[model samples]
Target: MAILFSRRKITAWCVAALASLAACGAFVPAHAENLDAPLVLVVGYAPGGSTDRMARLIAERLSPKLGVPVTVENRPGEGGRLAAKQIKRAPAGENVLMLGNPAVMVVAPLVFKDLGYDPDKDFVPVSQVSSYDFALAVGNKLQLDRAMFLVGRLWAHPEEAVFGVPATGSLPHFFGLMVGDALSVQPQIKGYGGSAPLAADLSGGSLPIAIDTMDSLYAQHVAGKIRILAVSGKKRASFAPNVPTFREAGMKIDADGWNTFFAPSTMPQPKVQLLATKIREVMQDPGLQKAADALYITPVVSTAAETAQMLKAYRQQWEPVVRRSGFAP
Candidate 1:
């Protein structure tokens, strides 16, 4: 038996299917259900990195809750701009997003002028993840009393001190610059490809001081291989409650680098709200918290609107810090 319908009848059937999804409430402010698109998460960094790990964590938990198949895609290079561009090109109704950090959003622009996308205009924030707390580490044989005292003494020394960083616009590099600016000295900085090389240099005493994140240095600090002087966090971290934060030391260099999830600039408000709401719910889960802690990350939960407000405030805050550090773009 042949089943056929007139053109008008087929159009009506298609319209009704979409209407049924809207009525089911699966996609937005109204929670409309749709068999239309799968939710996709785009990561700006290479796989095996923190951003990717975090993206997978959130996606795994958010899939069933959103009642859609969640897929993670890696589109690396250009320090996250590549992924950002991909997100921008996606259809507005498709759930496409990118996981990002300060390098893509804030630091790289200060150093590289030709970066193709604009954070403020090309993408919208979905969640503000936790700030990465940095630690000032030194080799064991250093003359300074501790990492903190060493920094103060190093600044006072007549010769410029040297520090190792992960990359030119990486958090460690900028943080070291900020610390030097605060101390009124321009320190020598060496940029390694990643954490492993930097650690090697630190161990070999070729690089005495390193400004690396707590998560990267926690294990070494516990094993007593490296000495931690000061932290970039506003408060002492739970794992290291004894160390002092930059604010506590009276310098007030609050450049705790951060990661925040984002979507294409044109994503509808209701869709943005729906996605942000789901991320917040997932981050709040105790099991997720434990998983993050195990991976040396801290879970941060916030609404998309709040994330936007925070970005605005942070841009204002970083302006002075960047200028003080002689950063020109």
Candidate 2:
């Protein structure tokens, strides 16, 4: 025979379960437990990409800690806007999170007229997972070692102003335009579907120069398939210390890009704090750090307050440049 609980008994049981989780600094929605809503990490890019790989890494270590089933969902489209939208519509108290980058969280709002959702109002920053800098790579056909040389070449040959960017409003795109302005040449940037194709073009001499995240081009650069002329950062990347920075090359262009984990706005503050703390713990794993290092990205763990400050800093640094570029939706 099956035993049934009265409404009062069920309510008391639910409250007791929540209290037990809170006593240990853990959080799991009682309703989610009742409905069996598994913890889901969302990646707003294709499978096998950097964001997807990072999401998988987080899920692997986070599942056992959270004591729940975890999975990664790829919702690729609109340069991460699709995944952001999905997170917006997620029900209150559901365990759905997304890996957010500047494209969706920072630049899109600065560029798009109708972004459909406000990142700050619709989502909550859990924790930052990694950081990287932008880089410019030259095809095998070009024999250049420093950014100044390419600047001179573009100044003399405006026809070679053609370049590649991973996405239209990405940090790389803006950084490419900034470099073009510094070169005083009319830059023609060709946006590709992803970094693989962009790197392929750079390798085959089909594209003379490309601007993208250092992580996006690290493999080909290490393989000696393409030459990264200058990195756009305050200093050279830690993984590629031999490479010179744009400032070191005397071009004065600098930028920093980062990736953070975010959840829907409806998630409770306690839940958000618990999640961010857990992510910080997961980021400390030696295996995770090793994997990130192999990809040429520096793994960083930041609190939600720190993440907000980073987004603000990037916006302030890029807004003037973007407005000066006169790029529109």
Candidate 3:
């Protein structure tokens, strides 16, 4: 009777302990437990820009899946450098991440002599959300549709090769350089505040030529305000299949850019993986895919290792190009 009583007591104790743990959420699923805190998605661009829009889209879909609130914070300045610097200094426990692009991720550090942040040491690539290609667009004053015609006009009148880019020393700026190099014409590049003003100038015919993301110029191109001549892709972009790629147009320039979520390197590997997995799942949602298509970006699902490798390859590919350009911001 004593032995049976002892066995009963032990069994009762185990059940009680498990019940207590369950109440305390000790045995709850890891994802749920780990994500007790809400996520703050940071965008380093102004409201309504592509990066901000993307951040909002991801956060909206991610909130339901993680069962936690997700918010997008805009810290727009210096083409995302300011926001990146803030993220670099964020505490490991903070559930804050930045949607970064090549302007700050790739081109800024490469060109800025006094850049304050070190991406390689301070930021870990969580996952790439989407990729986009740049396009060389011209104003209606040019009335040219093909690349060869534009090249001929620019070559014959070298002064007319002036080009506008979103920012100086950015990927689009360098892509413009690549275009100039390919056509044996030295383009005089101008840096605008952002795509809005650049597009405005292009539409008004103040800017003879410009290089920026395909999406930035698509609406104007569709409205017949401006004409996109060539995109910096290996093949034609789906959104504008009628427009030729630089390669298809017989130019040797091929470049693309992506927006990726980057977290502080101090974040634990498991946490990063969990967040990455959730993000990829959100990106795979059909609604998200349709939204991305409407925004002129291709949804991407890549592991952290792959994102890191992509950045590594990007650095390698751009090192020589940067050195050759000798551009100083």
Candidate 4:
């Protein structure tokens, strides 16, 4: 005997069948299963900068592991405020992240009055990728072999020992102030447009001494054009192992710059966990480690919770130092 079915009955049967398949883990919604959406790693700097380079590297290694395309998008402006704002407003998905440093994540809040995004409220910590320390370097033209000699010169002739920083309210500027305080000399910080011009002047003897990242000054130091007196971390940088840290030089100060990954605060916890795990795995890749080493950056893999703790501790450590600097943006 043949049976005839109404449209309602046919629809009900189809729904039941689909439910049974889903229960057996044999079915998934089309949108949920589609993982082809491209992931974007946003950088707040122009292309070819260190942050941009790191973002591209992570994207290259992460794409294959996640089975989707991953790319870096630069949104440089207002010292990374623009990029942070965009990340805060990114759609509710796991398709976007940002490579941020202390400047954007920690310092900008204290410095800028009307920052578009609040670091604590607008973003979730994903992971910390790498970190480096600043170096107190002097031009070779100064002919100073010891860091103490530079201190003595500053103490005797404070007017002649002007310090150059890449920009105002930058890590270098704050670190310079700390160094000056440690030496008991009020720092005279001159902020240049960028590091290149500062490097040029430092090498030419016009800028006697300067504070910048080891990554920025290591090549010049290696070329015997500049003398790196000390680094501003608890441990010496791998790239400049011979240089002593500020503590070792009798300065009770420690400052290190770091890179972190952040997702919009609205992203789901499970999605955040998935992306953080993937990124931790990507950092473990041998090829990526080698590449990071070449850039003089140490590759670190951390959980979201760990990253949050680190961020908190970093803020606690730097808040006083920044406030003491009395920098108004």
Best by lDDT: 3
Off by over 4 Å in 1: 1-29, 33-36, 143-148, 323-329
TM-score of each: 0.85, 0.84, 0.87, 0.87
Candidate 3, 43: how far from true, in Å? Answer: 0.8
Better of 1 and 4 by TM-score: 4
Positional deviation of residue 111's Cα in model 2 after best superposition, in angstroms: 3.1
Each model's total of backbone clashes: 8, 0, 0, 0
Cα lDDT tens digits for candidate 1, 34-117:
324678888877898777888888889888777888888888877787777677776666678888887778766666667777
Please identify model 2 stretches exceeding 4 Å from their true place. 1-37
**Residue pairs with backbone atoms closer than 3 Å in model 4 (clashes):** none
What TM-score would candidate 4 get against the native? 0.87
Cα lDDT of model 4 by residue, 90-185, tens digit: 767448999999999888898788998999999999999888889899997889877778878888998875789999889999888878778888
Model 4, residue 150: C-alpha shift (Å): 2.0
Worst 10 residues of 4 by lDDT: 27-36
TM-score preference between candidates 2 and 4, better one: 4
| Cα lDDT computed for each candidate against the true fold | 0.75, 0.83, 0.85, 0.85
Superposition TM-score, candidate 1 onto the true structure = 0.85
Write down the RMSD of candidate 2 (Cα, Å): 6.4
lDDT of 2 by residue, 240-322 (tens): 99999888888867888888999898876777777787788889999989988887878887888888788778888888888
